[model samples]
Target: MIYDLLVIGGGINGAGIARDAAGRGAKVLLVEKDDLAQHTSSSSTKLVHGGLRYLEHYEFRLVRESLIERERLLAIAPHIIWPLRFVLPHDKGLRPKWLLRLGLFLYDHIGGRKLLPPTRTVDLRQPPHGAFLEDRLTRGFEYSDCWVEDARLVALNCMDARERGADIRSQTECAALIRKADSWTATLRSSAGTQQIEARAVVNAAGPWVDAVLGQSTPDKPHENLRLVKGSHLIFNRLYDGDHAYIFQNGDGRIVFAIPYERDYTLVGTTDQSFSGDPSGIAISDEESLYLCDAVNEYLKHDVSPGDAVWSYAGVRPLYDDKSSSNSTVTRDYVFELDKEGGAPILSIFGGKITTYRKLAEHALHKLGGFADRSWTADEALPGGDIGASQFAGFLAEAKQRYGWFPADGVHRLARAYGTRIDRILGDATCLDDLGACMGGDLYAAELEYLVLEEFVIKPEDALWRRSKLGLHLDRHAHARVADWFAARKEYA
Candidate 1:
């Protein structure tokens, strides 16, 4: 059967488009060469922010839409998305506090402003929350944004797409694409070899690799002006005691972020250096690593060393080259170029973030026109997002009361991760023993089974890194043990 729309790439944009298309009654298929979000999506700074700094570039439109969506996503996915405050320490070298305050004021009024409070002024001299700053910083600002489990966001979208009847192919690469009269046929390759798939239209949602897909699908068309830049991040043991993330202005024109991550760690990142190698050929350069560590040490009382880095990752952003002199000055907004002259239409997307993926997809699909149908995902809940027909926490409490026999922590864990879907995942389980087998660090065989039978849980790493961040919690033995088991089964391959 030919799918109505075939989307290549499983990052946030690809997954978002798949879920949206599938929900609109289209027979959709989404293919990912690597694990979903293994590239740019997961490696992001993991903030669903409005790019408050974009105001300096006069990119008000992007900031407004992003700010609006930030709040909406937080409300819908409170389990994986929640409010986070950003602390912008004032540096006389950077923009004045008045300008920053003006931007924050505009940010506060954008969208989804009903629930989250507006920005607050902070005095570094006061007690609580501001002690981490250097004494030179006498005042600062704090505002609400959102923090996302970047990898889980993709997994959740994939799960939702599957539930909505979208065919999801993970670790599957599209070898070739040919315009077959009025449709497109794609040959997909995997460890098992290759298979042919067809679709009425193809969406080139492949971040970083979008150009490669275009080359295969429409070699004649050229994106003569395109830029792929590599950004890197480092993870550290928590440096300060605060729920708020910090935004620092380096002496250079660039900026750095220090976000509280994994409850006990700080994630700082992102250097926009132009990259010309393979899109996936990304690494954290020593300059970037030291730059980040130095930026943090300049602000915090506790100094962070390269030795403090527990983990580091990199990603390439395929930004639309605008001939900007500075890489940082290049726009973070996306551009969609369509090709309908070649029988079947193809839409190629470049430069978008997780925050605006929903709108991006809607606009991209609208550009596809006849190839797509009506949009229905604006307010639809992703799979496992429906806790019940009531208040999410209340629904969880009801389930916990009913299945109170399980470890209270386990139930609360489910409530936090799966929101209202805890009941569906829990089923009739009434006790810890009922959850089947114990894996490690709150991981049980039951949850793993659910992920396998439901979401595409093939490799142990997928279960550990993507579906959950239990990698940080699971002991070495637990990781080796589960990895050995998955290798023995060889199910994911």
Candidate 2:
């Protein structure tokens, strides 16, 4: 059987393409070398936001499209994507106040924002927003962006694609591609074995490995299309009380975000350093960690050191090489290289942010015209995201009311992780005891079963870390227990 679309890379772009193609009545097969979203997708700043900083680089189109997608994503997946107000504390040394104000004004209007509130001025000397900031910072501006469960976005997209008759394979690498006159034959290798699959078209959404994947098909055609920029993030114990996130402006014309994460930790990040090394298991460098700490210390009242970070992550962005002198100045917008000179078309994706992934999928499919039907993902809810178009607060209230027997905190976690599918996991369980053995933290047996049976969660890391961040909540013993559970399970064998 020939798939209509074969998508490589299991990040946001690949999953989004698979979901879009499958929903549009095309037979799609998506193969991920590692676990889904094990790298870039899971390691993002985790915001469905417009590139507010991209305005300085004159990326109006990207910003507008991102803002628009932010709204669309919020409606489709309110459980995972919701509004987050960002507090940008005004620093006298960095960007001028006038420039910040002007940028916020354009941000408010440019993307056709209606549901989210516009930007507002705040006095940093006052309570909530500015209470954690240093005394030197007196004023700031607040604007709206949405936070996303980045890995789950990829997972749910794959789930929806599978439900729509697409073959989703994790831990499967596309080793070779032989472009035929009418089709492309791909050799997919996994621990189980190598399997050759044929597809009418191929979408190379291989984030940092875009060139490598293309090189497999056209080894002689040298392509220097990606500018790999390493971005590192640190996770510290919760910094402040408020839910509002901070976007700090640095002296070096860059911005770092400190977001509320996992309900117990504060997520601080992202240094843009040029990286040329391999993209797997990338860890935060000492210099990058110190830079992040210093960047946040400049604005916050409480200073943090490298030792204070409990966890840190690094991801390499395969940005389109725009030949900008500095790494930070590279475009966040995506570019596609569609090659169809002698055989079946292959679209190679480069340089995209999490916010615009859905739209990026649409554009990618549109580029590979005649392979599938019209766009359908703009309105369709993701697999577990069909909790009506109602507000998240309303959905939470409904979940609490329906599952009154379950612990409120547990239900809340499930709601956030599985969304409407929480019911599917809970099933007929009327009490906590019905949830089978508690593996660790909120990691219950029933939830693990759902992840294994429904989502493609094969390893303990797949469940405890990527699919859900229960790893942060679980202790060393609990993590080991979960690992043992996976070891004994037949699925692991």
Highest TM-score against the true fold, candidate: 2
Which residue runs does candidate 1 get wrong by more than 4 Å?
371-373, 387-412, 488-493
Clashes of 1: 1
Model 2: lDDT to the true structure: 0.90
| lDDT, model 1 | 0.82
Which residue pairs in candidate 1 have backbone atoms (N, alpha carbon, C) closer than 3 angstroms, thus clashing? 387-420
The local distance difference test score of each candidate is 0.82, 0.90
Q: List the residue pairs that clash in candidate 2.
A: none
Candidate number achieving the greatest lDDT relative to the actual structure: 2
RMSD of 1: 2.4
lDDT of 2 by residue, 123-213 (tens): 9888875568899899899999989999999999999999999999999999999999999999999999988989989999999999999
